[model samples]
Target: MGTERDKGAEQGTVHYSGTEGGWGSVRGIVETALRERPKPAALDALRRQNKPGGFMCVSCAWTKPKHPHTFEFCENGAKATLWELTSRRCTPEFFAEHTVTELKGWKDYDLEQTGRLTHPMRYDHATDKYVPCSWNEAFDAIGRELKAIDPKSAIFYSSGRASLETSYMYALFARLYGHNNLPDSSNMCHETTSVALKDVTGSPVGTCILSDFDLCDAIFFFGQNPGTNSPRLLHPLQEAVKRGCKIVTFNPIREKGLEVFKNPQSPKEMLTPAATPISCLYLQVKTGGDIAAITGMMKHVFAKEAERWAAEKIHVLDVDFIEQHTDGFDALKAHVDGTSWEQIEQESGLVRADIEAAADVYIEAKRSIAMYGMGLTQHVHGSDNIKQLVNLFLLKGNIGRDGAGISPVRGHSNVQGQRTVGISEKPELVPLDRLAEQYGFEPPRDEGRTTVHVCEGIQSGEVKAFIGLGGNFLRAIPEQERMEAAWTTLRLTVQIATKLNRSHLINGQVAYLLPCLGRSEEDMQVTGAQAVTMEDSLSCIHGSIGRATPASPDLKSEPAIVAGLAKATLPPNPKVRWDDWVADYGLVRDAIEETYPEQFHDFNKRVFTPGGFYRGNSARERVWKTKSGKADFTLPKKLNSWGTEDKDGRWRLMTLRSNDQFNTTIYGYSDRLRGIEGTRDVLLMNPDDIAAAGLKQGQIVGLASDADDGMDRQVGGLTVTPFLLPRGCIGGYYPEMNPLVPLSWHDEESKTPAGKSVPVRIVV
Candidate 1:
C-alpha cells in the first residue's frame, strides 16, 4: 500500500518541455548528480571547457579524454555538470535563517536547491544556526579535537570519486595516525565483488576491459542498466549490436538502456531521431536470483556441450584453453552436472528453453564478456553470486582470453580505482607488506569494520563519529531510520563535500560541513596547479586537472583537507611526505609508484598522454592469476532461497531509481521508464499480490517492516499501486523507501546493505 502512481517517463518519449527537449530538467539532473545546484553560468562554463589538462567529468568514472569529441556527456555526466555549474549557493546566511531541523524538513531536492556551499560552517546549536568561520579556525578545531583523541577512534572515510592523490594521503594519514580505520564508499557497493573475485580469481579487480567488449560474441548483462546509470557504455553496446554481437540481460525489471537508446552525441541520431534497440535477449531473473540464473545458463551450456561432443560435434567449448590453463575442472564438471534443471528454472524465473536459448548464443559467440552491476552484488549471498558469475565465464573458457572475460561495471568513475589506490577496509598481506617495507612500521593486520559494522558499532555506541570524505553516508546507507539514530550517537562528524545534503542535517554532537572543490575546479599548489589521478572501471590510471574555479573561497582540495588534519594529529612518518604530497599531488603519485609498481609505473608522467593507460588486465592475454595460474571453475550450489515467492504475507521491497534520479541524488521526480512523474512515493506491485493483500491498486499503504525481534518498523505515507513487478516483490525508488531496509539486512560477506531485498508488510 504505497504510492502507486504512474511516473511514466517512458523510454524514447520526448517531453515537449523545451527547445533542447527539457534539457533544463536534464541539466538539473546533471547538477544534483554531482551534489551541486545549477547556476546561470553553466553553459558558458561548459563552452569554455575541454581545456587540455582538466580533470575529466567527475561523474561516472568512465575513461578520461582521448580523441576530440564535442561532448563526452552521459546522463549522469550532464547531471554532474549542472550541479557543478549551478547558479545557487547554500550560504551560511541561509543556514542562519533556517535551523538544521527546518532544513531537514525540506525535500532532498529543495535542500540542494540552496546552491553550492561556500564556506566551512559549524552548527551553533546554542543559536540553532550554522555560522561561517575562518578556514584556520575550522582546521584548528579539527587539529585540536583530533590531538585530544586516540588515533584508533578517528575513522577517515573516502568516496569513490576521491583521486589517487587524495586516497594515498588518506591511507597514509590513517596508518600513520596508528589505526587503519579507512572506511570508504566501496564498503557500500562492490566490496562483495572485490572480496569474492580476489578469493576465486586472485585479482581484486574485474578481469574484463573496454576493448574486451569488442571481441565478445555474447555479452551477458545481469541486473545492470547502462542506459540511465553508465550511459557512456551504450557506445560499446550499440557498437556490438551494429557488429551483430549478442547481448542477453538478466534483470527482473527491463532496463531502458538495454531496450533502446539514442546517442545524444550523434548529430544524425539526435536530429532525425532513431533509437537503437540494444539487447537481443532479456531475462527477468528475480532479485537475488542471479546466482541461480547464471548457474542455470551454465548448467544448460555444460550439458549441451557434453551432448554435442558425445555426438562428435567438433566446436562447442574452448577445450584446449581450459585444459591448458585451468585447475579443478573435474570437480567443477561434476558439481555442475549434478545441478538439476528443475531447481535452476524455479529459482531463475527462466525455463529450460530460456537457458538453452542463452547457451545457443554462447555457443555461437567465440568470445564473450559477462558484465554485471549492483544487482548481482547487493544480496545476502552476494559473494556467492559473484563466484557463480566467475563459474559461468570459466565454463566457457571466457577468462584469460580476448573478447571474453567477467566485468563488474562499477558505479562511480573510480570505485574500482579508489580500491586500486589503497582505500580498502581489509588490506591483505601484500598491502601490509608494502607498508612495512616503505614506512618501517607494520600496519595492523586485523580486519576492521565494514559499512554495516560501522553503523552497528555506531548504533551500539562503539563508533565515535563518521568522517565522510564524500558521498551521502546517511542516505546511501541502507536502513535509513537506524542509520539516522546511529548518526546521533557520534561526538563529532565532518563531511568534505561540494554541496548541501540530508547528511548535513543528520549531525553529531559537534558537526562540521567543510566545502570542497569539485573535480572541475582548479587546485593551485606551490609547484603548480595540481593534478589528481583516478582509476576507471577498466583499472586504467589517469590524471585530472580542474579547469573551473573553486565554488567558494573557503573550500579546499580533499587531499589537502586530509593532510591538514593528519599533520596536526599524527607523528612524523617520513616514508610518507604528508605536507609535500598535499602541497603537490605529484608527490602522492610518487609514493603510489613506490608501492604499486605493478600498476602505477611512472605514475606521474604517464597520465599526461591523454588516452591514459590501462592497468594491465591479465585477462587480455589469457593470463589467469588463480592458484593454478588459470581462472578456477567454481561449482554453484542449489538455490536455497525461495526469493520473492517465499516472502508471502511479508512484502519484498526492491529499491530502484526514477529516470530523472541518479544514485542517491534525486534531481527530479520523473522516471520515464516506469511512468512515474514528480514523486518517489509510489510502489509497483503485481496485480495478483495486490489482491492477495486485500488492497486496491493505486491506494496508499503504510508499509511496515518486520524486525528480527518480531516487531515492525511502521513506515507511513507510501502509495501502493498494483502494477507489474514479479509476484511477492514491490518495486519503489531507493533512499525514499530506504527507511524500510534494516541496517542488519546486509550481504554477510560484503556488509553492503540489502537495498534489493527487504521484508515488509503493508496496511491501508
Candidate 2:
C-alpha cells in the first residue's frame, strides 16, 4: 500500500537526487503496472501507446516521432494507461455501497483509484448515492433538464483529453442547442498563450515541430518540467544535448527533469548511472519574475548589438526580418531603453551580469527555441509575459525558421486541437459563419463564459447546467471549496468520463455519470472499430485506434456520447446528421475538413499516414495573420510587480503538479524526482524563507490568500520543506494550493487563474 498521511501533517522527507528518469523511472512504471489489476492488459496497452495504429497516451500533448521506438510511452504515460486500463471497477454496486456524502470525504486520488466506471448512474437524492440508470432514461432526463433551462445558463466544459472529433461534435451540439458557453481546460492554463500569441503572431499555436529540437542551437525552457509532464520530450532534449545544443532554463524551482535525464529506453544508460545533462544554465527566477527576466535579456541583446555596431558595424538584430516581417520594433526598443537595470534586477531577482550571461547565449546561438509552459501564463501579466517572450524571439528573428520558434509546451493531449476545432468561449475565435452555414442554424453571437466566468455563474445561480466532456472539472478549478458548494446549486450536471472522479461525487439536483471509453479501449461502432485523431502541442494531427478490449461493453465512445446528448436535446436539423457522424467518425472528419478546408482538407487520409500531418501554421511561413499583417513586437506597460515584495510576511506561491500527478488526476503519492514521497500537501520553501518566517523545517502551517477579494481563502496542514527557491517565492502542488487563489485572481487579458503567483502568508 502507498504511504498514508494525515490530512494536514507532513508525511514525507526532503531528498533531492539531482537526477530524473533512470532506474527510478523504470521502477515507477513497473510498480504502477504491478499495482494495476489484470496486469497483462495494462502491460499490453503500454507497449502500444503512442505507436502508429495505437492509442495516444492520455497524458501530455507531447508529439510523437515519425520512426518510433518499441516503448514510445513514458513513465507517466504508462501510469495514465494503467490508470485507465485498471481492473478495479466502480460498478453500480460500488456506488450503492458509498454515499455521495461519504465519498466527498475521500481523497481525490482515492476517488479515482476506485477505478473505471462501468455503468450509467444518476444521483438518488433520498439515498445520497448514485443509482444505476438506463442510457435512455439518463439521456431523456438530461434532455428535459437542458430544455427547461435557458441555453445561456448551461456551460459545456471540455477537458483536454477529448479528441478533435469529439470536441468538434461537442462544440457543434452546444451551439445547435442555442448557446456558445463552450469553456474548456484551456481557459485555465494556456488561454494567455492563445490571447497573447494571436496578437503577436497571426496564429495562437506553436510554430515549431518535433524535429525543430534537433536543428536548434539552443532551447530555453521557462516554467515547464518535461521529465514529469512530458517525459517523451526529454528523449529529444537528451539527443539535442548529446549533439552539443545548449539548454537554458528559467523557473522558480530547479526542476530535476531540466537538470539531468537518463533514457530508460537505452539499455546502456539503464545499466549505468550516466545521464544526459539537460540545462547548461539554470536561472532560478522569482515567482512572476519572468517578464523582468525576459526584458532584461532583450535589453542585453540590444546593448550588445549597439556595442558591436560601435566597434565594427556588426549587426546582432535580425534587421531584415524585423524591418520587413514585424511591427512595433521602435516602440519596444524605446520601452526596453527606458527600463532601468535596477528595476530589472530587483523585479527579476537576478544580477545584471547573470541576465547578460544568459542573453549572451541567445545572441551567440545561430538558432534558438523559446519554449514555455503555464509558468509564463497563469499570472496577472501572463499575456504580457508571453508577449515579451515573443518580442525577445523577434529581436533575434528566432521564429518562422527551421531551427527556431516559439513553442508553448501544452499540457493536455488535444487542448490545442479542441481550440482549433472551435471549443472556445470566444465566439470570435471560432468560424461561426461556417458553423452556422454548415449546421443550418444561426450560431449564437453573444460572448460566452470562460472557466472563471462559469464559476462565477454557478455562484450567482446563473449557470444551471454543466456538461463535462472528460475531466475532473470541479477538482481542477480554483476556489475549490466555494466551487464545490456552488456546484450543488446546479439543476443538472452531466459528466462523460472513463473513470470516477471528485466531480461526479459533487452531485447536483439531477446529475448523471455517463461512462465513456478510455483511449486504450476499443470503440466499436456500426462502421467497425473507430479511430479518433488528436492534435499535439506542435499542431500535428494523428490518428489513435484503441487496441485493448473495452473496459466495459456498455461504455460509449466520446463522439457517440456527444451525439446521443445532441440527438436527445436539440430539435432535429437536416444539415447536422448526428447519427451518421457518430456511426463512422469519418463523416465527422469530413465535416471538420469542410469546416476547416485550409487545415484539415484531407484529415482522414493524411492523419493515418506515418507520424500524422502537420496543421500548417501561417506564422511559420512569415505570413502574419494579425491586424497589422506583420508579427508585432508588443511592449508591456511595465514588468510584473505582483507578488515580489515580502510585505506582511506573505510569500509568492506558485501552484505546480507533482511527478505522480497529471492535471487533477493523482496517479500516486510519490514525486520521485523532487524527492517527495507519500504526500502532496507539503510546501516547498527556501531555507531562508523558512528561517525568516520563524518556522523550522517539517513544521506544519496554513496558508491564507492575500487577495483583495472579500472571501477568506485558506488551507492548512502543509508541511514546510526547505529547498533552493528564491526568497519570498515558494512552491506547492496544484489543486491543493488552488484554494489560495480566488476566482477573480486571474490574468487581466486571458482570465487564466494566476495560480502561478498567489500572495499568501504562512499561518503557523
Candidate 3:
C-alpha cells in the first residue's frame, strides 16, 4: 500500500478521493435488493400514529410526530430507514459460505454489504459460520452464560436509537441481572454535558424544547452543525428566521448546511435545489476553546451591566432573576473579572471585539436561547464546557422562563427518553427507589459504568459478558479497534438489532445476533397491538406505532426478546413477571407510570393520542426539582486545559460523520458537506497547516497520532482539502480514522472519549 510520494510520508495506501462510482451505485443496491425482495413495505403512520406511539425515529433525535411533510426526512434519515426496510436478508446460507476469517477481511460496508438479519443465529466456531438457531436455544444459551458470570463481570451498552419502553425494560432487566455495569452511546458523546449540567442545574436535559425555539428572539448555537447532523432542525431554523429570530452559530469549520438550507415548505425555496441561508451569525471558535468563548461572552455582558450600573441604568441585567433564582454568582463574577483579555483571546481564538459583538446581539434580545451539540462536548473538559453554557443562560434568568434557556440538541430521537426511563449507567436515587416500590423488588443501588468505562472494564477483564440492544456497538465505539479487542475477550456478547453489522463478526467466545423489529416494523402484542412512549428533546413524551409489517415472521419486538432472556437468566419472580410485560407492553408502561408519576400520567390513557403529553418540568414549567429550587449557574474548570499527552501541536482533532452516515451505519461514503465524494479518505485541514506541512490542496498525505501506545504505526494517507479552520486543528471522517483516537483520552467525569479532540501529526 506504499503509494505516497512525500519523503515524510511512509504510510501505505493513498485512497482515491472520489467514490469511484456514484449515486448510481446506491441506485443499483436499491434496485438489486428490490428485485430479490419477497415483499415491499411502503411508509405510513405507525399503528398508533395519532394515538400514543412508542417508536423513536431511526434518524436524528429531533423529536416530532410522524406527520407528512414535503421533506419526509434528511438523506441520512432516509438511508437509515431504507436500510431498516431493506428486503435483502443475511440468511444462514450466506453466513455458511463465508468464514469469520474471510468476513474479517471485508470492509465495514462490505460486511453489512450482505443485508439485514433474517433470523436469530449463533456462531459455530468449528464451521466458522453463523447458523440459524431456534429462539429458545439462542435465548437460553445467552441466559445460561450470562448467569454463570457474576453480574459485576457483565456490562450492558445502550444506543440512542432505543425507544423509552425498550430502554426501560432493558434497564429493568440489567438491574435484575444484579449489576449496574451499564454503558450507553451517551458516554461516547454527551455524557459530560449530562454530568456538568446536572451538577449546576440538577437536570440532565436541555432547557429549550421545540416550543421555546419557536418563541426565542435570538439563539446562540455553539459546536453544532445541524445541516449534516440534525437536518430536521433546518425546518425550525428556517421558520424561526421567517418569524425574525437571530440565529448565531459558533463552529470551527464553515458548515455549508448551517449556512444554507433549502426549506421545501417555502414555495420559492422548495422548487429549486438551492438552499436558504439559516445562521445569521457564524462565529469561527477554536476546537477546545468553547469555555473561553462562552466566558468571554459573559465577561462582555458583565461589563455592559457594570457600565449600566455606574450610570444608574434600569433593566440592564436580569438582576431580579439572578438574586432570586441562582447561587455562586459572586464567584462566577470574580472569575470573569479576573480573567485577562490575553488569556481569553489566546484560548478562545476570538478577540474581545468579536465576543462583544455576539454579546451585544444576545443582550439586545428580550428572550434569547443558546443551543449546542456534541461539537462542544467531545473534549477532556467536555463537562466544563457545558457548565459554562449553563452559567451564561442562568446569568440572564433563562431557565424556568419562556423563550430562553440552554439547549443541547441530541442526536437520536429517544436518547433523552432512554435516560429518563431508567437507562442510566449511573441511575439516580429517585427512579431506582420508585422502581423498587412499584415492582416490589429492590432495584440495584450501585452506580454503573458508562460506555467508555464498560469497554475499559472489558479490556481489563473486569467485565466478561456484554449485551447491546439496538446499537451498532462495535462500530459506534470510539477507538473501535480497542473496543474490538475488549469485545473479543468477553465470554458472551449479544446484539439485538434490525440490520446486519460488523458487531456480528467481532464476537465473544459465545455470541448471539437476535433480529428485532424496527420502528418501521410492526410489533404485534396482545390486546390488539400496542404503543411505546418516547421522550423528545423538549421533554415531550409521545407514542409511536410501527406502520410497516415485520420484515420476517421470525423477528420479535425488543420487549418480547427481553422477556425471552429474562425467563432464561433469573429465577422466576412472581412479582416481576416477564411474560406479563411482554404479553402487553402497555403493562410495562403502566409499571413505568407507577414508578414515575411525575413524568408519566396514565401511560396507557395518555398514549392513545398522537401528540403525547410533555414530561412534568417541560410541560408544567416547574423548577421545584433543581438543587437551588431554580436553575443554578455552574462554573467550568477552565478552557486552556490541554489534554496531558496532546500538548505538542500535533493538531487537536475531532472525528466527524459525513452527511451519508448515521450512528455506526454508513449509507454512502461521500461527504457532500466537506466536498469529499464517494469516500471518507479525505481530510479537512486549515490552509496554514497545508502550507507549513509543504502540502497543497488535493495533495495526499499521511496522518498519525503523536501519542505512543504499543503501536507507533497509526498513520494513514488521506487526500488533503483546506478549510478556514483554526490553526493546530484538523477534521477527518470517523470509523476510517477511529483507530487514531486513544481509548484512554476520554473524559473521566463523563467517560466520553474525546472523539472530537484527538491530536495528530500530518506528514507529506
Candidate 4:
C-alpha cells in the first residue's frame, strides 16, 4: 500500500557539493510552511512578508531592498515566520498534561511544537503546572515582587526580536523603576563590533549601507556563512560576481555559501542550470587567528607599497585620505612590520603566498568592503580582532567612502535598534539630562551589569529579580547548567514571549509567563491598529505593520505589557501617564523623538514614509567625530592563543548553530545544509585528528574543557564524525556545547564569552 510520508521525520545523513539557495531551498520552505500552516495561511503570510507596509521577518537583520519583490523572504525567514504562526496551541489544557519537570525533559523543538502560548500563565506550586491568570493579577503579583526588592537587585534583559518602540519603553520603564541593569542579546553577539568599531570609526554602527555592494570592487568576507545566517545577502554577492567584483572569504570551515550560490529569484539563472561562484580566494584561518591573518596581509601591503613607492615615486595607499582623516598610522605600520611571516603563517594556518594574494586583491581594488559575523566576535580577543580588520581597511582608506567600509553582520532583526533606543548598561551611552528633563525622572547614570556581569551577580546572590523582554536566557548564556541553576534562586523571573522555551521551564520562587503579541499579529489600541518601527543592519528605520489577526485574543502587545507592568510597579507620578502612552504608540515615538531630538527628528512622519529614513551615521559621510577628530589606527597589543592545545592535548572547540535552528530555537532534528540528519549530538572533527585520538566514526565520546574556573564543564555522549575541518579543531552545536564554555572565558573589554574558541579534550 502506498503511504503518505511523514515529511517532518528525519532519515539519514546526506551530503552534497551543490551551492545553497536553489530549488532545494524552495522545497525546504514550502515543506516546512505547509506542515505548520494551511495553504491559504502560508500563502497570505508569504505575500505580506517584507512588503512595503507588511510585517518584518523576525529573523536576521539583513536590509530589505528599496523596491522589494513580493516574495522577499528567504527559506529560513519563511521557516521562522511559519514557526511563529503555527496552529498548534499551548493552552491551559496542554499545560495540564505536562508538568514543569516533564516539560524540562522534552527536546527544545518538542517544547516549541506544543505551540503558541494562549494566555498569561503563573506557576502554581501545588499543581506543579502553569495556570491561567488575568493580566491585572499577573501584573499586580509582579509589582509586589518589584516593590519588595531593591531596584539595584532587579536585572532587565532585552532580546533583539523586540521592536524599537517596545525596547525604548522597556528601557525607560526600567530606569524610572530605579535600576540600570539593562543587558541584552547584543552583549552576546556583536558587542565586540559595537565597542571596537566605535574606537576606530568614531561611531558604533558600520560605515557601509546595502547599496555599497553595487559600487564596491571587492568584498572580503571574514568568518561568515551567508547561506544560512543571512541568505538575502547572496543576491548582492551574485550581482557582484556578475559585475566582476572579487569576493575573498576567510573561514575555518568551507561553508557551501562561500563556494557558490544559485539565486532562485533570478529568472535568467533559473531558466538555465548555473551557480554563481562566490569566493575567488577561500582561506581557512585557524580558530581565533583572524588577527594574525589580517596582520600578515597588512605586512604584505606595506612591503609592496614600498616597492611601488620606489618605482613610480607614489605610494600604493590613498595618501591624501590617510593624511587627512586618520591618526596613529605610523604606530600601526611599525607593529605590522615587526610581525614575522613565520609566526603569522604558523598562527593563521595560511601560507605567506595566499596572504599576499588576498592583500594584492585589497590593494588593487578602488573600493572594498570587509564583512564579518559572530565567527570573528566570539573570541577572547574579539574586540582586538575587529580592530585589526578596521586597521586593515584604514590603511588603504577603505572606510567612510562610497562602496568601501566595514559591515559587521548582526544576528537579530533589531539588535542595533535596541541599542540605539537606550538598551545599554554603559552610563555614557545613556542620555541622562534629556531623559530626566523630558520624563520627569532622574535616569541612572552609573555603569551597570552586562550579560557576563549579570551572570556573576545572579550566581553571587546580588541580583534577585530578572525581567526578560524577549529571548531564552537559559539557553543563550554561557555555562548553561550554572545559568539555569542560578535562575532558580531569583525572587521573581518574568518572560515576555509568544511560545514555550527553556527559560520558562526554570522558574524562580515566583514566575510569570506573560504571553505577548508577535510582530505578525495586529496590535490594536485605543487609537486603532498601531504599527511599530524596526531598524535594519544598514541603519534604515522602517515601519512593520502586522496584517495577520492575533494568534490569541488574550495576548497583549509588548508595549502594552510593559506599560501595564510599569503602571502597577512604578511609584505614583501624576506627571507621567503610562495609560496615555499605552493608548497610543505614537506617544512613545514622540517621546523617543523628544529624548533624542538630534537623531529622531520628525519620527512619526518619517517612519510612515515609503522606506522610512536613515539614522544618519557620521562615519558613513566621512565625518570623523573621535576624540582626536579623526579615525584612529589601533593595534592589537598581544597575539591571542585561545584555541591552541595545552599540555593535555586538547583541541579547539567552537560552538555553532545547526542549519535547523536559529540562536537557541531548534526548528527540526536535521541540519539540512551539512546533510546531517536525525540528530545534532555529533562532533565534527578532522579525519587525521580522529585517527590520532583512536576514535572511529559513530563512536560516542565525552568532552571536557581546559578551564579550571571552579566550574565542572563537560559534554558527554557526542558521536564523533569525520569532517573537513583543520587539524586540532572540533565543532559542536551551540547551547549543547555551551556547557563546555566557562563563564570566565570571555573577552576582557567587551565581556563576550569566547564561544568560538574553547579548549577541550575528548574522552574515550
Candidate 5:
C-alpha cells in the first residue's frame, strides 16, 4: 500500500493530506455554487445566507454569532443554497419524458441535478410515471388512504431541514390524526445525544452556547470532523487556539480541519497565509472506542486528583459541586479506580501516558468544553459514550457554568429545534396536557416507533402508509434495498419535498410527491411574505425570511402542506384552525406557544428580535430535572472498542458523508477536504491493514459484514485507498455502505443504528 502519488492516481481524483480552509475553501465555494446557479444568482443567495432578515443556510446546524461579518456562509453552505436555488426546473414535461422507472435508474446526484419539482405529482401505475395533479386532488387522495388505514399504521416522518414552525404543525397534525408514529432525521443522527444528555445532565440540548468558545480554556473533541461537516465552527476553534486554549481531539481518523485552519474571511490570514494550529494534542482512538477513551480520561483525572490530594492536601475533584449538583459520584469514582490503565490502552488504542496528558490539560484548565459529533453517537453503545463524556465533564463541575459544558455538535439546520417544538416518537416529549387543554383533543400517550422500528413496521406490513415531511427517508435509513421493498408494502407514501430524490423514485402502491418551497424561497400566503424561525445547534431560535422567488408558483411551504393534509384528513374542530394557521405562520407560533408555553413564551414576538432568543436550558441553570433532581454520573457497564475485538483481522467500517455532501444530499463527486475527488467509491484504510490483507492500493474489493442478520449485506467494487487510520479501522462513504450495516445492530435505548461501527471482512 502506498500514497496517492505512489499509486499513480487519476489526474483530479488523487488523495493527499493538506491544511484545511484557505484559498481552496473559497475556490470550492465559488465552483460548487456556480455549477447550479449563475454568478449573480449565486451571489444573491450567498449574500442572503445567514444574514439578518435573510434565510439561514440549510447546510449545517452550526450557529451564527450575535454579530456576523459579511459572507458568513461557508463552502458547504453555499453548495446547499445553490443546490436549492438552482435555475433548472423539473417540469411536468420532464416527468413525461422520463418514467418513474427511468428516474429510478438515475444516480442520486443526477436526480437532484434535474432540479426543483414544478408541480404536485401522483404516480400513474399504468405509465409507471408521475403526472401533474392539483394540490387538492393530491391531499384528498392522501387523506382517503390515511382514513382507510389504522392511524397507528401510518408513520409521520420528518427531515431535520424543516423549520420549527413546520415541525410543530407536522407533529400536531400527526397527533390530531390519531397516531403518534412520528419519526424524524434525529432518529438516525443525534437520538443518542437526546437520550444520553437528558439522562446525565437532565436536559437534551447542548448546555453551552457559541459564546462558550471564547470563554473556555480547553475544548475536547470526540469523533467529529468540523472541516467538512461544519466549516463555520473552524473560525471559533481558530479563535480559541489564538486565545491559547488547549484543543485536544480524539478520533480514529486524523482529520485535517482539527490539525490547523485558516479562515478565508480573515484578511490578515489571507495576506500573510498564517493558519492557526488547532488540536494541540490529537489522540487517535479506535473505532467505537469513544466510551473507553472518555473513561480513560476520567480514570487519569481521578488518579491525578488522588496524587494532588496526597501531596497538597487539596481536592482536585469538585467535591462541593458534586455534593450540591450531582449524585452517584462515589459509585463512578469506585468504577474509575477499578478500571486499570491496561484496559484503557487496549480499548482506546491510547497509552496511559497520552490519556494522562489529556487529563492534565483538562485538570489545568479552569473551564473547558467537550464538543462531539455523529462519530460519538453512531455506535451500539453510543448512549454510554455520551454518559461517559458527561461523567468526565461533571467530574470537574463543568455543568451550568460559563465556558464549560457538553456540546453535541448537531448536523441539520433545525434538528434540535424540531425536537424543541415537539417532533418526537416519545410521548412524554410532546406536551399532551397542553395540547388537550389548548386544542381540545387527547393525544396518544403510548410511545411510538422510531426510524428503525418504522422500517420494521413497514417490513412486517404493520405500517401501511408513510408520509415524509421534507427528507430523503428511503436513502437516509439503513438497509436501502430492504427499505425500498418495505416501502412497496405501504398502501400510501407521500413525500413533501422541493426536489426529486431516491425516496420519491421508490414508489408505494399509491405515491404522491408534493412540491414544497425551499427555505430560501419566498413563502407568500394571505398574510404576505412570511418569516420562519429555526433553532440552531446552540439553541438560538432566530427568524429566517426568504426573499428569492419561488422555484415554481405551485410550490407550497412545508407548513402549508402539513395544514392541507391535516384539514383534509381530520374533521373540523373549533380549536384547530388549519386554514388560519396556513394563512399566517404567526398563528402556528401561537399554537406552538400554547403547546410549549414554558419554552416558547412570547414566541411570535421574541423570534423577531435581532439574533432571536435562546430556548434557555435547565442544565445551564444547574437545575437538574432528573428523577433524583440532580445530574447523575452513570457508570458504563459494557465497554467494547469497535463493539468487536476483530480477532480475525476484520476491519471496522464507519460510514461518512463526503465533503461535498450534506446529510443524504450529494452535491458533487469531490471531498475537497480529504483531497479525494471524481469518485466516492473508494475506501480509506490503514496501510498496514491493507498490506496484511494482501490488497494493494487502488485495488477493487468487496465488503461483507460479520453480522448473522441473515441478510446478504454486501457492497462491491470499492477501490482501496491507503490513508492514515488506526489499525483494524476503515472508512467508506455513507448510503453506499449503508447496506453493509445490519438493522439489528443499533443502540438499544436510543434505537439509532450503529452506522459508524460495523464488523466487516474483505472479500477476496
Candidate 6:
C-alpha cells in the first residue's frame, strides 16, 4: 500500500516523489533560517559552519570535507544552527509568567520554541515558578544538596552537545566526586556498537575515514536513514554512485535518501530534473530481523565460495587474512551450516532469493563498506546484530583496508568524542590511573549506572540528585510516564542547557536551570575567545570557534559552568587547576593528552590541523587489541533479536525520526521525505497488517506494549497510516513511541533500550 495523493492527504499526510534534497531541502533551510535568525545573521552562520576557525554543526557527527564547499552545512545542520542562534529568548520574566506545573502541560516543540535560556534560574517551590538566581548562589545550593547525599546517589548525565574540553572536565568532576556514574547520550544510541565492535574488532569506534567513501566499490546500509539523521553523508553516497559504486540498503522502509538524492548545493542538478540515484538495490528487512537477514547473507557468501572452490580451483573467501588476522572461522561456519533456510526466512521476513540477491552484491564487490545506525543497534540482540555484520565483512576481509571497514553513523556531533574523553559508565573504558595521577586523587573503580540504570535508580529512589549536561533527559528515555512521576521525588535536579526543554519543567525538590553558551555563540573567557574540539564519526578531531554573539551576556561556556560546579562541590586540589583549565581550553586538551598520551599526543597542536587529525584505530591498522590478539568471528545466541515469537497477532514496532527532527528535539510537524506532514502522532503500518487488524487508513488507535514486565505501557491517539513495510511490522516517531518501549526491554549486554523493536497490539 502507498500513501494516497488526494484530498485526504491535506488532513495529515501527502505523497511526494521518493527523492531527497533538491528544492524541498532548500525550502526547509530557507524557512528555518528566516524563522530563527535575521537574513544577514543566517547567511553568515551558514557560510562559517564546518569551515576552519568556525563552529562545528551541532546536528550530526558527519565529518567536514577536506576541500570545503561554499556551504558545508545541510538542511538539518542549518536548522540546528538557526535554532541555536535564534533571537527568541526564554528569560526570567517568561518563567515568572508561567509556573513549572503549567509549563509541563506545553508540547515539546512549544517548550523548546520558547527559545534559548537567558538566565540562571532556580525553582521556587513556594511560588511554583523559576526565579533568577546568581551563579554563585546556584552553585552553593547545588553543592549543599550534593554534599547531603551519597555521591553514588547522584547521576551525572551528559549529552553529545558538549565539546571535548567540557566533557573531560565533567568526567574529572564525577570521578573525583567518588563515583563513575557518567551516563551520557551514547548509552542510549550507540552503546551496542561500542560493546559489539570492541569484542570483535578491538576498537569501540568505526575504522573508516571520510576518504574511504571515495575508494569503496560497494556501500551497504543497514537500517540507517541519512536523509534525517546525517544529511551530509548523502553527498558521498551521491558521489560514489556517480563513480559506478554499488549501494545496497536493507531497511524495513525504503528510505528516500538512499533511493535518490538531488544535491541542493549543485546548481546544475537543482536547476535540471537530473538527480543522483543512490542505492543500487534496496531490501525491506523486518524491524527486528537484521540478525536473521545478515546471517542469511553470510550463508550465501559461504555457499558461493564452496561452489567456486569445487568447480574451479578458486578461493572466493580471503582465507589468508582470515587465518592471519581473524579467529573462530570454523565455529562461525558450523553455525551457518547448521541453521536452516526456513528458519532464516521466517525470522528475516524476507525470502531466500531476496537475501541471496543482496549477498551476491556483497560477493561481487572487491572493496566494500558496511554502515548502520540506531535501527541495528537499538534491539534485544543489538550487539549480536552488529557482530553478524562484522562476520560478513570478515568473510571477505573487508575490514582494516582502504575503502573497506565498518562505520556506525553517530547521531550527535560529539557523542563519539564524549565517550572517547571518558563520558562513560564503564570505569575501565577511561584512563582512571592517569586521571588519578594527574589530579592527585584516587579515582573510583566501581562500575556505574547506564541510562537504563539511572532510570531504575530514579524509580527506586536511590538516585537522589540528577545533573544533566545539555539534553532533555527525562523526555528522551523510555517509560515516559514512570519517569515523569519518579522525577518529582529527586532532591536536586540541575540542567546545564542552552535552551528551555521539557526536562527543565520537571522540577525536583531544588532544581536549577543553568544557561550555557551554544556552539553558534562566542564563548568568551579569561584568556580570549575560546575554541573547543569535537570528534566526528570518522574519528577526526577538529577545533570549533563560535562566531555568533551569545544569546545572553550572563551565560557562561560549558567548561566554565563545569569548573564552577567542581570548585563549589570539591575541595581545592592544587594539582587540578579547574579555573586555569576553564580560563584556557588548551590546558584542558593538554590534560587530555596527559591522560591518553597515545591517542592525543600533541593534542592542542594536532586538533587545529586543517581537516583535523584522525585518532588512529588499532583495528584499522590490523593490530588487534582483543584478548585473542586478533579479529574474532562471533555467532549470536539467537537468530531472532527480539525475545518473543511472532504470535498472538503482535506487531513489531520500531521508533524512527522525522526528517524535521533530530534526536528528541522536534524542528517541525513535517517529515517531507517519508510523505509525512502536519503531525507526529501517526503510525506507519503495512496495508496487509492494517487490514488483518481490522484497522482502516487514518483510523485513530491506541498501542499497548506486549512486554511481560507487568507495566501497562500504552500510547493513545495515534492515527494509523499505510506505508511500505514488511508484514507484521510498523513504524512511528521516537519519544512519542518511547512510551511503548519498557525500560526493562533492552539489549541484554549493553542495557541500551530496544527502541527499534517493541511488540505491541492495537487497542480500539
Question: What local distance difference test score does each model get?
Answer: 0.72, 0.87, 0.73, 0.85, 0.85, 0.89
Kindly list the per-residue Cα lDDT of model 5 for residues 450-564, writing each as its tens digit: 9999999988899889999888988888888778877887899999988889999888899999999988888899989898999998898888988788888888889889999
Predicted structure with the largest lDDT when compared to the true one: 6
TM-score for each of the candidates: 0.92, 0.97, 0.91, 0.96, 0.97, 0.98
Give the root-mean-square deviation of each candidate in angstroms: 4.1, 3.9, 5.5, 4.6, 2.8, 2.5
Colliding residue pairs in candidate 6? none
Candidate 5: minimum summed lDDT over ten consecutive residues — where?
Answer: 1-10
Report lDDT (Cα) of residue 272, candidate 5. Answer: 81
Per-residue alpha-carbon lDDT of model 6 for 384-492, expressed as tens digits?
Answer: 9999999999999999999999999999999999999999989989888878778888999999999999999999999999999998888889999989999999999
For candidate 6, which ten residues in a row score worst on lDDT? 1-10
Kindly indicate the candidate among 4 and 5 with the higher TM-score. 5
Better of 1 and 5 by TM-score: 5
